[model samples]
Target: MKARIFVTLKGGVLDPQGRAIHHALEGLGFGGVNDVRAGKLIELDLADGTSDEDIDAMCRKLLANTVIENYRIEKAA
Candidate 1:
């Protein structure tokens, strides 16, 4: 099985990397960009019998920092 995890900072959290990217975009003359946010995409290869519960546990325990980040999981067909 293959799974993908998207991890992003929660609203109201400070994102220095995102800010830097936004500034760089403006410097490059790309206009009208109001804001920028950065995130992570994690792909995982699991055994065929891996359960959803285990995958959720993986996110909660290590893949994401639940306090300041949110994660969504998508299983590949």
Candidate 2:
């Protein structure tokens, strides 16, 4: 089984890295980009029958910082 975790900063949080990317895009003559936000994608290979609760625990405990970030989990065969 495969699990994909998407982690991103919540709204109203400052994103220096994202800002930098946006600025660079502008410098490169790209236009019409109103905003940019950066995020993380983590892929996990797990044993079959891994419970969703266990996956949620992994996200809460170590995969994501719940205070400033939000995470979404997607399972794949």
Candidate with top TM-score is: 2
lDDT of each: 0.98, 0.98
lDDT of 2 by residue, 1-77 (tens): 99999999999999999999999999999999999999999999999999999999999999999999999999999
Q: Backbone clashes in each candidate structure, one number apiece?
A: 0, 0
Runs in model 1 lying further than 4 Å from the true structure = none
TM-score of each: 0.97, 0.97
- Report the C-alpha lDDT of model 1 over 1-77, residue by residue, as the tens digit: 89999999999999999999999999999999999999999999999989999999999999999999999999996
Poorly placed runs, candidate 2 (over 4 Å): none
| Candidate 1: 10-residue stretch with minimal lDDT | 68-77
16 in model 1: Cα distance from truth in Å?
A: 0.5
